[model samples]
Target: MSLEENATNRHGSPAHIQLPEQLSSKFIDRFIRLKTTYWNREYAIVLLAIIGVSITSQQFNTYIKYIDFMNQPNKTENFHLYGCLSYNLFGYMIGLIPGGVLATFYPAHNILGICVAISSIGHVIVIMSISYLNSLTLCILQMCIGTTMAVGDLSIDRVWTYWVPLNKQSIRHVPMVMYLVIFEEGYLRDTMDKLHNEHSSYSLTLFIGVIGLAWYVLWLYVINGNYSFGSLNRDFILFGGLNNSRYSFEAYGNSLTRSIVSDIPWKSIWTSKPFLAIVVLYVCDSRLYQSYYYNTDLFSNDVFEWTMRDNTVVLLLLVVVLVELFPEIALPISTTNVRKIWSCSYFGSLGIIFFLEVILGNTIKNNKMCQYLFKEMRHLYNFGFYVNTLDIAPKYASLLSSFLMCIHYYISDILWASVVRPILSFA
Candidate 1:
């Protein structure tokens, strides 16, 4: 028995693993040293931080506003705006499949920078199509906008994962959220709108061209494809053609790199129970995104009521002035229970919102209260998003969640592109 005990003990757990208390001053000191010494690779990180945030902030802010602007022909009917949003979202969702594949191959920084620049073309195209009376241009612009948005969104996650140490993804998302906050406040979008009004579509296009020029300069100067470029141990690389790639993730430290395209975690991800729950959670995010609206126009003049504008003004004020009027509640729960609550809350709210719309506020003039209530409610939606993000670790949280977005968007796109848009046209 003693001999058996000794043999079993010999195979016992290794002792090299440190206790929790051992993660003390020395552990922190090394991380600090790592950051301070410019030890992090990828010069593009700094530029990506600035430009990616800028593009996303402005793109989001102004992208939807165009639906309103497009409906400038009639001030009263903004339901067409929702149609436009659906158009954008549809395009975005459809394009993400190829977008993810492209990100796997492309030089991430360059692709991101180019995507940002080209997205402006999409905006300009909308203006030209409207002004010059050309549906062709509008279609082109819409398609491009969808494509660029997919590419840029993909690049942000891709590049972030590359440069940010696996440890810092959560902290990184906070700044990303800050940029989102900026867009929510309408800094860049409003600026673009003002520019659009002041200039012809061509002139606006030129203005965007200048912004693109600046972006390219910044991209080339600061952005790089890999972090601390030793050997590109990264998962993938761009090749000669539109849809070719070198390889993903190096095996061993061997100089001879190998293709890992097949090794993508798709099946495992889809099969895992936790992954499925997260997928359901993220699918709810898409719904929350849609429901965070002052309109239920499923097209035409039934979207983004006047109350949305008013509530936006109020939201900025309350958030800025009181600081603590609304508690920035951070829920620390990633378990199934939390996901269930959040999903139900959002879904329940959506149900109630629709119910109220039918009973109290169905028509534009009749449903002023419904419109107004939703304006307030939309801000509440942010908390739902917060709850969802809060429960998870930030590391690849943006990514893994975004992957779900990729899937949702893809399916939504197919439905929208094939069924929704054509039906709307007929209707």
Candidate 2:
């Protein structure tokens, strides 16, 4: 028998005949499930977000260290340091709302690309401004960098909403990423400090710009290839040519129809106890966090006389291990209780450590123990805050988050400007 005839007789279709829908469906299903044992697009996007945040954080550390290094010669009060840091908070205050709004209307990937571009431009400007070193100019550049970083940070949450599966498995990785970034960059800062390279700051800024550009390029490739942006399917393409039909707010049920314009029920949100509680919690946490971060290095150096290498080693042994490993231990337990247990343990331990440090003062020679306790506390606090943000109001999560961040940054900025600066100068 001829092949066609034999095929038709056996399978009810000729061998050469094509069923495009069937073939495409099969291919898509296989592609989605191909790496069931290992990886997927969701994991890829999360990893990219982690890496981008890491690079940006490293750059931030470089900026902080650069300011300190610049001030070493004059032995000034380091007031400019607070000014630079406050400018970052100010930028975050202004940028977060717009970032959240933009993410709602545009593809998150596009917004992310713009953020990275702005960050790169900010880094270049910082490098150029090094010649002048004017406080105003540096503050402005730092603010721009802060704006881009805040926008990119907020945008990542939205991207996760779309890409991450809605399951217990979708725990936030922000705490772990933060710990890793801080640990690695702390080591780098220590090494550079040891070298005593006055020019390292310039080199670090240039390096950050290059990394930002590369991240943007890689993001474009990965997002285009993996995400279904407005029915273009899996084909990778540039941003401008994207079809916006499917990615709109209306498609996502976030837009208000004319009939429902007056039915948004804003009063309930205002009066809701949980909502109010979350807002309060966020503010207090942010304030504490800002104070801790701004003072830790200064306090360690001045009080304990700990070198950068000692601090780095202590953090690596404590925070890095706890933040990276705790999730694994907690994941097997009930989701609702994980945050509670983890948080209580963290704060309780931290409180004890702080009391001991204050009472013992400089007489305590165990720098390693003190450093370990402080690092662990910082990590746990961050992890707890992150978990709380996710747990409250997931449906309006983006709005709640942006609002909380705006408040947090504004308050933190004021506190830093008014209280932290004077204290540091006096110390």
Candidate 3:
């Protein structure tokens, strides 16, 4: 009836069937290329989803800046601001472990979408009730927002690890870099603030929530059937959409098992030298960056004798530099030992810049230039230590990232309160 059937005898099994080896190989190669193309599209969508959620979650930061706390007493105002800020970090720290654990047990795309949707909804509620917000209420809302953001962040990070191959793993960092670049450029702040002032913050926030739901719907379409956890019986291939299960390939079985490690080696991970080194590097880098960010206005006022407009101008200039240089300078650097090399070199230069800025504090030009260079160096940490956690342990990448970040937050709080603040006050 057909070529394959015609090759058989009257018994349907008496003939020796042969196929051209070249033809078979060509067919396999073509399938592989098609699969690669499919996965590349999936990866692009993953990055797009990441960009969407990150922007929505972070948009609230600008709105929070506009909140009126001037009516309260000085002590009350300070508590509302600083206390709520601490609650945000605390909530994020608490969420990280649970978020990572949930991602390990469930579908990452679902988790990301749901978490972001909930976060956006939460922000909408908070913004709707902005007039009723007090210190306690604001703190509670911030903690809730922080927890959801942590979960969303973990889910996206975990999903990419599952979706992307080792050779192309570095591209996973691009979404985050782009997020930073966009926010630093003040595009979101300028546009969203204008919308909020003209229309309403609640409407804007609700729109973001709708987008989050759309992300979930898109994920369901993209990763259903053979790609998700429910398709364990399907062929274990990098690309999805296969339904046949006749072949019992041991390699496929092994790979499927490897993807979900039932037993995580916690003891080995904690005691590992590389893990400890990465933790230390990240902690130190975060401490410097956080301290600098929180103290910028104070430092500008006290040390530089700069007005608010001058400080804002300095920030805008710094953003311009980041926008122009980040892609050209940071994106091309492969995730290799060179990441560490560049990070260390840039970090070391900060001390020199800081010294010069402080020594020549009276000169506005020197102060502005030094401040820009010093702040720009902090971005190198993302290219280096931030991605190192994922590179070292892809299966537990979210878990490890959350753990390290939690530790950094805790340590930063302690060191800032006990050591750094006192030194700055004395100086």
Weakest 10 consecutive residues of candidate 3 by summed lDDT? 239-248
lDDT of 2 by residue, 105-184 (tens): 56665666677767776776786677677778788878888887877777666555555633433234443335444554
TM-score of each: 0.53, 0.63, 0.64
lDDT of 3 by residue, 20-113 (tens): 5655786677656545643476666567656646655654564364453232445335565576567877787788878886665555655676
lDDT of 1 at 102: 49
**Residue 58, candidate 1: how far off, in angstroms?**
7.2
Per-candidate local distance difference test: 0.51, 0.60, 0.61
Better of 1 and 3 by lDDT: 3
The order by descending TM-score is 3, 2, 1
- TM-score between model 3 and native: 0.64
Q: What is the C-alpha RMSD of each candidate to the true structure, in Å?
A: 12.2, 11.5, 13.2
Query: By summed lDDT, which 10 consecutive residues of candidate 2 come out lowest?
Result: 234-243
For residues 243-300, write the lDDT of model 1, one tens digit per residue: 2233223323323212223435556656767666656655655555564443555222
For model 2, state the Cα shift of residue 178 in Å: 5.4
